[model samples]
Target chain A: MNSNGTTLRRIVLAGFVLLVTTGVRADGDASPIYGVRMPEGYRNWQLIAPAQEAAPLNELRAVLGNDIAMKAYRAGTLPFPDGSVLAKLAWKHVQSPEFEPASIPGAATTVQFMVKDSKKYAATGGWGFARFIDGKPADEAQHQTCLACHQARVKDHDLVFTRYAP
Target chain B: MNSNGTTLRRIVLAGFVLLVTTGVRADGDASPIYGVRMPEGYRNWQLIAPAQEAAPLNELRAVLGNDIAMKAYRAGTLPFPDGSVLAKLAWKHVQSPEFEPASIPGAATTVQFMVKDSKKYAATGGWGFARFIDGKPADEAQHQTCLACHQARVKDHDLVFTRYAP
Candidate 1:
């Protein structure tokens, strides 16, 4: 793009290769207990915020929200409504060959989702959770830990870890 | 969100407030020659990439693309199509008191755009550019420089600088 091409939170896409490196769906869908399927068009969703993980994970991630979720976020609605959906896309952080300080999303590790359906998921505080690796749903036991993690942590903010990033 | 609460490109919004610090807009709209105006519902655009400025600018900026722009990006379409539009949202970078390593978007700087209209902006490579501060367009002299700047740099990438950050 030019010197300014050096620009976007920096533009590093190398041509048409899109999404994660190991991104072929295995035809399996939906987490076992919660039955939450991967959201449609989740990749096109707007960002709620960017996040980084430390130590073993050492990942770069972003949380994205569906339209209803975004509307709630923009309005600062504390208790999200029935249709709220959040997707967390995570990739292993890799050192940039070109820039020393920058780390790019490399080898996507997971795609997780949090869906809100007050009556549908009352056991998990009005939310349903799912995690996928290589587009395949992880084990039910893996999903079982999602609510436990959210409850132990941000039970106050409706189990959403991401705040809207301006 | 618990310790994970420390997550998103890190969560810095103090509360429910969203968007730029100086977000209020006046009656005047659209740049003079291009007649390009602030896009409706642009805050919801998807992120293309994130960029940082050095020295005097010291800013954190992200480029956003509307549906058309996103399609072009996802498809790796060089010389973005006639309907493509890119929005660059800039903010001054400020230190985070809680985390020494993290910096957050501080004061609002400027919002700039490159709008594509093949027939309308034929002179500027089918793209019309606009810059706004506090929702007001800069002077015509300032507008005149947009083409010259882009031409000197990323004229090769259809004058677009961002790549879709997966």
Candidate 2:
């Protein structure tokens, strides 16, 4: 090949590699689980459910979803379609002094997310899970527990606990 | 007073001082503005409205309120009674690729709050304002702008912008 043609071909190949790497990273990290980033604008997504937990983890929880997740939730589609994303925000539960006996939120504890991509997260039932505390990613050990708990309890509901509040 | 009686009185006075300081800090900082904390369980509070802003500060915002605020909103009370607390959570806006043309949330931008206490905040039109970004308080100059904008644009609505969605 001519010198200029060779140089052009090499540049194109390098560009292709960079593009692929960027795409992979954007989808998620290398781990089977904990690959999902906190999905964009998840708080504005439709509310799937709200929950309160007692005992060791006294938390007030809210589950929200992106468009694909909301559509699947409303339609009752199982094995949720690709591009579906769910975010669960949790806070420590406190008592409302102004409204005696009523519970209120304390400090925020965690923000967890699940992204459904059948091909990408096929091992973990086609879903990638992640948890963040104050916007920082949780460790791998913590991430492992997410799949185990969901698989054991809510495997039937596509390994999800919250139902569509609507 | 006897020695034991004097000691008891001193202890009581110290306790009272401690309690008062704690209460003041809880309601807000020393500044007239930026005193409100993210009210406990605000995410679980009733959602009053959801909004989107364009350009410069493109954001998706959700407004949530405590029981007193929710009741007042439902009852259509104009002035919003004392004990009402409203939280506005905003995030960077992004597009949902799965559902093209629909916007989704990116990273969170701020969590702002308005607290009504007629006796306490009578100086600022019965409301105290605060803004936090990533859990840290915004500066005094930024906080001052909150009341100015609200007083100018929404003075009639008691300095609130979002109407109850229901």
**Maximum-TM-score candidate:** 1
Quantify all predictions' global Cα lDDT against the true fold: 0.74, 0.70
DockQ for the candidates, in order: 0.09, 0.02
Residue-wise C-alpha lDDT for candidate 1, range A25-142, written one tens digit per residue: 3245879898877876788888776655555786656678988899999999989998888998877767644344445566779999888889989878999898999988899789
The digit string of per-residue lDDT tens for model 2 on B1-166 reads: 6999999999989877865643333444333363666565565566665555546776656678877898899899979998888887777656543324334566789888888888888888899888887777788888878777778777778888766532
Lowest summed lDDT across 10 adjacent residues in model 1 chain B is found at: B15-24
Write one digit per residue (lDDT tens) for candidate 2, span A4-84: 999999998887786564333343333334556655445556665545554578665667777788788878999899888
lDDT at residue B38 of model 2 (Cα atoms): 55
> What residue runs in model 1 are displaced by over 4 Å at the alpha carbon?
A1-27, A50-60, A91-107, A138-145, B1-27, B31-35, B47-61, B91-108, B138-149
How many clashing pairs in candidate 2? Answer: 6
RMSD in Å for model 1? 17.1
